[model samples]
Each structure stands twice: as structure tokens, then as C-alpha cells.
Target chain A: MSQKSFVWFCLLPLAVVTTAFFLLPMARLVVAGAEGPHGLAGYLAILTEARYRATLINTVLLAAATTVVTLIVATIAGMFLQRHRFPGRAVLIAMLTFPLAFPGVVVGFMIILLAGRQGLIGDLSNRIFGEKFVFAYSIYGLFLGYLYFSIPRVILTIMAAVQKLDVGLEEAARSLGASPWAVQRDVVLPALAPAFVASGAIAFATAMGAFGTAFTLATNIDVLPMLIYTEFTLAANFATSAALSVGLGLITWLILALARSFSGSAVAAAG
Target chain B: MSTAGHGAAVRIEACGKTFADGTRALDPATLDIARGETLVLLGPSGCGKTTMLRIIAGLELPDVGGKVLFDGKDMTSVPIERRNVGMVFQSYALFPNMTVADNIAYGLKIRGVARGERAARVAELVALTNITGLENRRIDQLSGGQRQRVALARAVAIRPGILLLDEPLTALDAALRDRLRSELNRLLRALGITTIYVTHDQAEAMELGDRIVVMRKGAIAQIGTPREVYFAPKDRFVAEFIGAANIVEAPVENGVLILPGGRLPIECGATTANATVMIRPETIRVTEAGEGILSGIVDSVSFIGDRQRLVVSDASSKPLNVDAPNTIQARIGDRIGLSIAPDAVRLLPSEPRD
Candidate 1:
């Protein structure tokens, strides 16, 4: 075959997959969002309706919180792990990243096993404080589950970034009369800003779209994913769920873009 | 610049470094650097020169009984930040996420200098390092030489008591390295900070050092002025390392040194046993065949811009390297006579075995 034809042939698989699996489903979802009882207004119900709007806000807040807390925890842990050497460190890192292989449902179940009504936290709290404390089926439980999985993904990126850091930079900062804290705040953190954005985006997007964890711990949770699940399966409200899915994807992408541009400007200012 | 003449006098006494991995990077040694002196730790790689610099910089602690005194104050336990030293890394570890102005102002800002004062200091340093009009430029946008200048400016902006440079010019290309070497030498003189420079390049050591401490295998080999070290090396290693020296292993009979081509008189050095003599290439003059004390067959000639280097065999056990004048007309396989002053032949203390 000619070179031009060979290039087109190489692209044939990607083109077919995108058209069949992505473009068609996305087009169908958009159409279905509009074909409800209220026509195109069904799509706007994601913002106009009280229940959908509240759930969307809740989901965005949870994802944002998870992303921020995960970045902080992961950055600290990763920096410590990358810089120090001790026995059992390899085992500790392996255990920390062990959650990366876990599905969202497994994470949700693990959260419940620790904080459910009949779980470890409740038993311990009942024995110690004479009052059972339980929070597995609420938004907090889902938040915990999101964090458990998100931390593993974020920490690995942070560790790699910390490893790539020049020890000389820290020494130089210290030589310049910067204290230890100043070294981290000025030199270390600014150098790792790109890594934070890259990994934080993944955590945010995952939390925003995650369904299994919310579904498994769905008693008092009202996240976008849980709402979409019930609207599609329980209430048979296909149009509303389809609209919510599109909104969820757009909001996650928008937030990640905003975050990237903010950090980009920050890096620009530093550079 | 008022801090020029009164920098710290650093004395490292019995300082040695044995890393946790059991690698003895430095042997216990003592040295005193005078206030405003430029001391260079010159050595090849893995020669413990950087280890000694780090001990002075307080980046690395010495073994037990080690003491570092700065102007009579014991500062062995002080960290690098509290040590009040300025360090320039080989990699030129300029903060990439900062403007050149911000980087230079970093140390001043850390010491709580006011914004206006910081800006003024940065401007002065920017001018001092010849990096004018680069205040707002990011580190990534700089050339290698520019980054080196920025690093120096940042280190000097705080008016540090001592300046530590670890192979600061090793990262640049040859032409740029040569240019920066002289510039750095002038800057060191102008600033007059008690400086500890580490480098493997002997030319850099010669140009920048008030006194050069030649190190080998984690121990101090010799310490003297560049001219002293070059003319009066203590051993075979220092003689061969500093510059091109043809090591002639011959017997000293009375005051004369016996060689394969001819015998030359020597004033001081190994008098009894077999003597290991060092003859500098530039010191050996090329005379007509049979006219001088020694004659040899020309092996090869290398024209080095200003001078031509001729390798003459039969002068000694090894081929003698002669840096004759560029005007001399000599070629491969030509007979050349060599002449040298008695003072030019340095008899090293150590005698090499056959």
C-alpha cells in the first residue's frame, strides 16, 4: 500500500472505535436528555430542579474536598517516603498503593466495615464512650471511600515527582538562609505544582463520576452519581440521568481546566 | 561591598567523613583558610574534594572529634542555614519557578529585608554579575552561562561570610568555561569572601585559587600556591595531575641526574636513591641536534595554536613532552636536542619502582 493509505489504515481502528463507542453513545445520550416529558427543558432541569441541583452541588463539593485533602495527605506522605530510608518502607509503600487495584465498590465496602452501624468504629465508640457512632451510609462515608482510592493514585504521582526533585535545590535554599519550612513552602511546593495539578485532576474527575462507592453506601448519600443511578434504574427516569451524566462530565472537565490554568499562571509567575 | 575585607576565617580541624554506607569519602585533615582567602579543593572525581567543601559549608557533618571553627566560634553543629554561608551548586540549582530577580532577592527576603531594599540589592547583584536586563527572565529561558551568573549573583546578594562553589563552571562548554573562570576569579577578588571552591579542572584551580589544596583518594596530597604546586609537586600524582609533566625515573649521582639521552644537573631533591624527576613541557627548550645536554628522535608534533608540542623519545624511559615555540620547524622522525635549567627538573620525594 501507499504511505498515505497505510497511515489511514493505521487510523482506521481509532476512527471506528470513536464513532461507534464514543460519538454514537454521546449523541444518543444528548438526544435522550432532550426527549423527556419537558423536552429540552429536561436537560436544564439538571440546574433548575431543586433535587438535581442539590445533588450536583453535593457531588462537586465532595469531589473538591476529596481532591484537596488527598493532595495534602499524599504530598506529605510521598515527600517523607521519597526522602527517607528505613526498614519496612518498601512494605509500607506497597500497602499504601494497594488500594489502586481496588474497585470503588470494594472501597465503599471497606469504609462500611470500618464505620458502619455494626462495624469497628461503632463497636469501639460504644465500648469507649457508651454511644455508638456510625456514618457508613452517609455522604461522609462516600467521601471516605473516595479518599481511600484517590490517595493511592495521587500519592504515587507525588512520590515520583519528589524523587525527581534535586536535593541541591533544597541545600541551595537552606544556604540562602531559608528555614526548613521555607524551603518546602517556597522551593519544594512550587516545584511540585505541576504534579499536584496532574494528579489532583485525576482524583477530582474520579470522585465526580464514581458510582459504585456511592451506590454501595447510598442510604443518606445524594451525589450526582447516586442520583443518576436511581433515576435510571429505580425511578426509570432515563432523560434526567442522561442529562446528569453530561453535566457531571462537563463540570469535572471545567473544574480541572480551571485548576490547570490557575496553576499554569502560578508557574508562570514563579518562572 | 563593605563586607569585602572582613570575611570569616574558617578552620577545619581533624574533619573526616565516613558515610553510612561505609565509604570513607574523606580522611581526617586540618586546614586553615584566612579571612578573605580563596582556597580551592582541586582533585579528580571521587577524590573527596566536594566532601571537604560540604564539611565547611555545614551540609555534611564530620566524624567524631571533628571541629569547624569560623573566626574562633565553634560552628560544627550549625546547620547550613544558620551557618550564614552562600553555596553555588554544580547544576546551578536556580529556582526554576522564580524570576532571576526573585531568586537573587530570595536570601535577602528570607532575612526579612524590606521589599525596596531587596530590589536594590537584586539590582546591584544583577549589575555585579553582568546579568543586566534579566531581572524578569525565568530560569528556563536562560543560557548555561547566564544561569551560572544568576546563581553567583543570588549567592552573593546576601553578602555571605563565606562562599562555597562546587564545580560551578563544570556544567558549561569549554569556551564558556574559560570565559567564566577569569570572570569568577575577578569576582572572587572583588568580593573577598572567604571562599572554598571545589573543582577537578587544574586550570580553574590555578586561576581562581589563592592557595590550592590538591586532593587524591580522600586525602590532602599537597597544599600551596598554584605556582608552588606546579613547580614543587610532592609526589608523582600531583606532578602528573596539575599539568603535563614528563616523569623521568633516573638515578641521581652527586648533583647530576642520569638519563637515557643525557645527564642533567639538579640542585635539590632525592640525592641518594633512584630519583623520580618531573620536567614541565614548557620548561624544556628544543635546541639543534647534538647542541644541548639531551638529544632524542621526534616522535610526533601537535600544533596548539600558540605553541607546538613535540614528543621526543630516547630522552628518558618515557617519551618527553616538549612544548617548544610555535616558530620552531620540527616534524615527526626528526632528531631534536633538548635543554633545561637545573631548577626546572623537580625531584619528587617518592621514588617509583621499575
Candidate 2:
């Protein structure tokens, strides 16, 4: 084969896989979203209907909260971990990032084990306040689970960025009469802006569309993924579930694209 | 002046640095830099010149019992932010996110100087640094020389009482470095803000410093004017470091230096049986063979544009590096006589231990 043909030949497998697994399913889902009794207007029901709209808002707010809290916690921890040396620092870092090895369902179960009706928080609250402080099967539980997993991803990215930061920048800022807080705000944070956007986008997108965590704790919550799960498996409403899935994917993608553009191409493809 | 009479009188009293890992970067030594003096800390890499600068700049605290004072006020416990200093790093350390204008105005903005005043100061600095038309450019968009200019402009924008620079021009190319050296020298002189510049380049030290502090192995070797250090080095290291010098270890009798090639006179009453002599290459004049005080056969000749360097053997204990004028006619294996003025030979206090 000639060079051009050989290059095309090397890309043939990728093309086949993309068509078979991604493009075809995505097209089918889009078509399926419009194949209901309401026809093309079925897609509009995602926003026009109260229950779906409420669930969409709930999902977005939860994801946004998760992204914000994760970034703050991770940035502090990552900066501290990167700058200082102490005994057991290696072990502490390893333990902090251990959640990266876990699936969402596992993270949800771990949250339950810490805050469920028979869990540690409940036992303590029951003794002190005469009431169990259970919050496991609620949106709070899902939020906690999302934070657990999101923090590690953001922390890794932030730690790498902090490692690459030049100490001279901080020194120069201080020499110019910038206080410690001002140095952090002006020099350190702005330098880590790209890392924040990249990792925060992944955290937001993951929290938006995550399934197993919401599935495990869906009794008192109405996240989009849980609603879609119920519509598909419980009610056997395939078209509505497919439409909601497309909505979830579209909102996540839109937000990620906005983030990437805002950060000037710093964001990678969202997980 | 050994010490300038005016900006901020800095006293580093027995300041030393021992990192937490127990590596001693600087020995306990005291130094006083006078107001408005541009004192250059000159040394090789790892010689603790930068450590001393950082101690004075308040970036690093000295070991116990050490103290730093600025204008009679103890500043050892004060952090760098409150020390009212301006620093320029070898890396430039320009804020990449901000435009050059914002960066130059950052210190003023932090001081609560109004936006209008900040802009005025930034504009004044831009003109002074010769970086016009670059106010809106980001740091990453700048070339190395331009970035250097921006860094310097940003550093001086604060009107700091004491300026601390750590190899500011070391990152630029040689030609750019040379040009910026004179420019920086002029700026420092104009500002007269008690500058502490740390560099490993001797030419930079000579060109900019009111006094050069030569350091080696975590200790200061000598502190003197450029001419003093070059002509009358206190030790072998300072003699070899400041400029090219031929150290001849030979017996001395009645102010005459006895060499392997011939005996030469010096302007010192050195009655010692053996003396270490430092002779600058340029001070040794090339004359016709058998006519001058010392003679040697040229081993090799390198015609550098302004002068020709001849490595002549049999002239001393070591092969002498003789810098003859380019107009001289001499080749390898040619016998030549060297005439050095009596004042050109300096008697070092000790021999080389390393």
C-alpha cells in the first residue's frame, strides 16, 4: 500500500469501532427520543414537564455543588501534600487517592456504612439527640459519594500542577510586597487555573451522568440518572428514558465545552 | 565607596543557612551593605552567594543567633512580603496570566495605590525599561530579552528601598546579557536603591558592583573593588576566579621572585623563603628573547581578536598564560622574553590547598 492508503488502513479499525459502538447508538438514541406518542415534542417534555425539569435542576445543582466542594478540598490538600514533607506523607497521599480505584456503587455503599441508620453517625446522634441522624438513601448520600470519587481525580491533577509551579513566582510576588493571601490569589491560583478547569469539568460531568451511585441511593432522590433508570427498568418507558439519557449527555457535553472554551483549551475530554 | 551613604543600610549579622536536611549552604558570616550601594555577590555555583542574598531578602531565615537588620530595625523575623524589597529572578518569574502593564502595576495595586496612579507608574517604568509598545503583551509571548526587561520593570515598580536580584540576566543569550548588563547598571545607578545582586559572572560583577564579594565553598573569599580584587587578590582562589592569573609558587629573596625560567622583581618586601605570586596575563609584556627579565618557549598560540594568548612552558612552575597584543609576531616553539612591571606581581597570603 502507498503511504496514504496505509494510513487509512491503520484507521479502519477505529472507524469500524466508532460506527458500531458510538455513532450508531448515539443516532439511534436521538431517533428514539423523538419516537414517542408526542412525536418530536417528546424531547421538549424534558424541560416542559415539572417532574423531569425538577430532576434536571436537581442533577445540575448536585453536580455543581460536587464540583465546587471537590475543587476546594482537593486544591488545599494537593498544595499541602505537594509542598511539605513529613513522615507518612506517602501513605497519606495513597490513602487519599484510594477512591480512584473504586466504582460509584462502592463509593455509595461506603458512604452508607459511615452515615446509614445503623452506621457510626446514626449511633452517635441517636445517643446524643435522641434521634438517628440517618441520611444514607437521600440526595445527600449521593452527593457525598460523588465528592468522594471526584476529589481524588481533581487532587491528582492539582498535585501535578502544584509540583510544576515555580517557587520563584511566589518569591517574586512576596518581594513585590504581596501578602501571603495575595500571593496565593494572584500567582498560585491563576497559574493553576487550567488544572482547576480540566479536573472540575471531569468531576462535574461524572457527577451529572453517574448511574450506579444514584441507583444505590435513589429512594429519596430524583437525580436524572435515577429517573432514567426507573423509567427504563421499572416503568418500561423506553422512549422517555432514552430521551432523558440524551438530555443528560447533552447537558454534560455542553457544560464541558463551555468550560474548555472558558479555560482556553485546558480541559481534556470529560470522563 | 565601600558602602553607599544613602538607601537602606542592611546588616547581616553572622547569618548562615543550614537546611532542614542538615546541609550547610552558608557559613556564619557577617556583612554590612551600605545605603544605595550595588553590592554584587560573586561566586561559582553552590558557593552560597544566592543563599546570602536570600538571607538579606528575607526569603530564607538564618540559623540560630543570626540576625538581619534594615536601617537599624531587626528584619530577621519579618517575612519577605513585609521587607519592602523587590526581586528579579533568573527565570524572570513574570506572571504569565497578566499582561505586561498589569504585571508592572501589580505592586502598586497591592499597595492600594489608585488605578490612575498605578497606570502612571506603569507607564513611567515602561519608558524607563525601553519596552514601549509591549504593555498589552503577555509574558509567554515575549522573547527572553523582552521578558528580562519586563521582570526588571516589574521589580522596580514598587520603588523598593532595597532591590534583590538573583542572576537576573543569566537566562539570556550572551550578547543580550552583555547589553542588559550595562542597561541594568545604569538603571541601578539611577535608582541607587541598595541593590544586592547575586551572579556567577565576573564581568557582570565588575561592570555593576560598587564592591564585589567573591565567595567559594560556602564562605566569602574576598570583598573589594573590582580593581582591588583583580590586582591584589587576598588568596589563590580569588586571584584565579576574578580574572586569568598565573600563580607561581617560587622562592623569594629581597623582593625578587625566583622562577624556573628566570628571577623577576616585585614591589613587595617578601623575605620569605617561598612565596605564592599572582601575575595577571595582560600585565606580562612580551619582549624579544633574552632581553627581558624572564624567558620561556611558546607551546601554543591562540589569536583572540583583541589579543593573542600564548601558553608558554618553562616560564614558571606551571605553563604561563601570557596575553600578548595581537600585533606581536610569535608562533609555537618560539623563544620569548616577558617583562612584567614590579607592581603587577601580587604576593598571595597562602598557596592553593585544593
The parts of candidate 2 lying over 4 Å away from their true place are: A265-271, B1-6, B269-273
Ten consecutive residues with minimal summed lDDT in candidate 1 chain A? A262-271
Give lDDT tens digits, candidate 1, residues B1-354: 766786799999999999999999999999999999999999999999999999999999999999999999999999999989989999989998889999999999999999999998888888889999999998889999999999999998888899999999999999999999999998999998999999999999999999999999999999999999998998999999999999888888888998889988887755665778899999999999999999899999999989999999998888999999999999899988999999898888765443
Model 1's C-alpha root-mean-square deviation from the true structure amounts to 1.5
Candidate 1, lDDT over the whole model: 0.91
Highest lDDT model number = 1
Worst 10 residues of 2 chain A by lDDT: A262-271
The prediction achieving the highest TM-score against the true structure is 1
TM-score to native of every candidate shown: 0.98, 0.96
